[model samples]
Target: MIKNEKIKATEVQLTGLNGEDLGIMSTRDALALAKQHKVDLICMSLMTSPPPCKLMGAGAAKQEKQQEKKKAAKTPDKRKVKEIRLNLQMEDHDRETKQSQAERILTKGDSVKLVIQVHGAKEGTAGKEWAEQLCKSLAEYGSKTTGIQVSGKQVVVQLDPIE
Candidate 1:
């Protein structure tokens, strides 16, 4: 439906083709006026005692309404999660690259998940320390906008949006 489709006032005020008021009249008179103008009698408001309506080209009005609906539907909501993965033993260059990727994702209005997976016997104290260092580096380089948490063998960091 058109935005604020309802018309206000009891005098059955009509609007011209350029949206100027065409004065008040009875329902029958308005219908006759619409017929004379070769347009449709559209009931815009039913709140008043006699209700208020409009006289306009039905096809053009419907097309405008559909266009507005499509415009509203195309707008994107901002609260969506986007995920990125990393390994516990990722090299300095690879970690930097992944961090850049996460930054890009956050810039696009998405939350990023930085996952670090640990494997085998190498998943010892050194591995944990390495994970912590990586997390710290990511936080420092990414301006600490990310939320970090540890879950067993995985170190997950959620990157916040830029401003």
Candidate 2:
């Protein structure tokens, strides 16, 4: 926004500090009016034939911008991914513990990557069944985002939190 002496328009549509329209007048007159009110002559728009300007305290505008920045800084991104590893040989208690951890992360608005690693032969046929069962167990907290995929010795699937 052009302010005070920086404004080049010879005439402008002015508004007072109290928001009352002062109508169209010379830029010099508007500057003098702002000086009398101890405020800034800020050009609001340049689209009209004679640009529009308003009277406002510069310190107030600066404070508002600082407040907006602080408000933006307070919120953190929630799209982070948490990884949990499982295996076909996991015991009941171990599986339950991993499921609880995944549930905790999902409830906090983070996604989870489930990885079941198979060490021996028949990687595709052996690992997918266990992965499906695990996925069903976690259905209440999150939905599966990807189909069970088998690559070499690893079976991977992604789950996104329910919003």
Candidate 3:
């Protein structure tokens, strides 16, 4: 998390709230001065050789920071991944429907996971090829993050984030 408020220091060469130079003093003395004027002691810069700070409204400053965080979180970034499943013998119509759903999810800035199940005898002969074909078709909808992998009787592939 990042802080957005410019804090005021207690003492030192008091750069006024608006950046005016007010000379030096102790943190306690500066805080007292700000208190007399009804303000907060904000530490703006503490990394200098002697450390520098500022003064502001603690509550208002915190609220403004929270608002900025909320705004940033609301801005969509295309890095989240969503998952979908398919069976080895899934009908063409069903596969198409699932692909449509995947497209919707990807359009909203999400990656997709295509999971295929290979059951019993279906796991033999051309099961692996079938899985590969399913992965290929899905890749047409979105970039491939991970190629198909067979684990026991299931195949899994991850889709890259949609552009």
Give the worst 10-residue stretch by lDDT in candidate 1: 1-10
Please report, as a residue range, the 10-residue window in candidate 3 with the lowest summed lDDT: 1-10
Residues 3-115 of candidate 3: C-alpha lDDT, one tens digit per residue: 22333333354555676766677766776777886766555456663345455567865885799889999997747777788886778899789878887776666788877
Per-residue accuracy of model 1 over 30-105 as CA lDDT, tens digit each: 7677778888666655566555456779887798679988999999776577677777667889978976887676
Instruction: Kindly give the number of clashing pairs for every candidate.
Output: 0, 0, 10
Candidate 3: list runs displaced more than 4 Å. Answer: 1-16, 19-26, 43-52, 77-80, 120-128
Cα lDDT, all candidates:
0.63, 0.88, 0.66
User: TM-score-based ranking, best first?
Assistant: 2, 3, 1
TM-score of structure candidate 3: 0.62
Pitting candidate 1 against candidate 2, the one with the higher TM-score is 2
Error of 1 at 54 (Å): 3.7
Which residue segments of model 1 deviate by more than 4 Å?
1-37, 43-53, 73-81, 107-110, 118-146
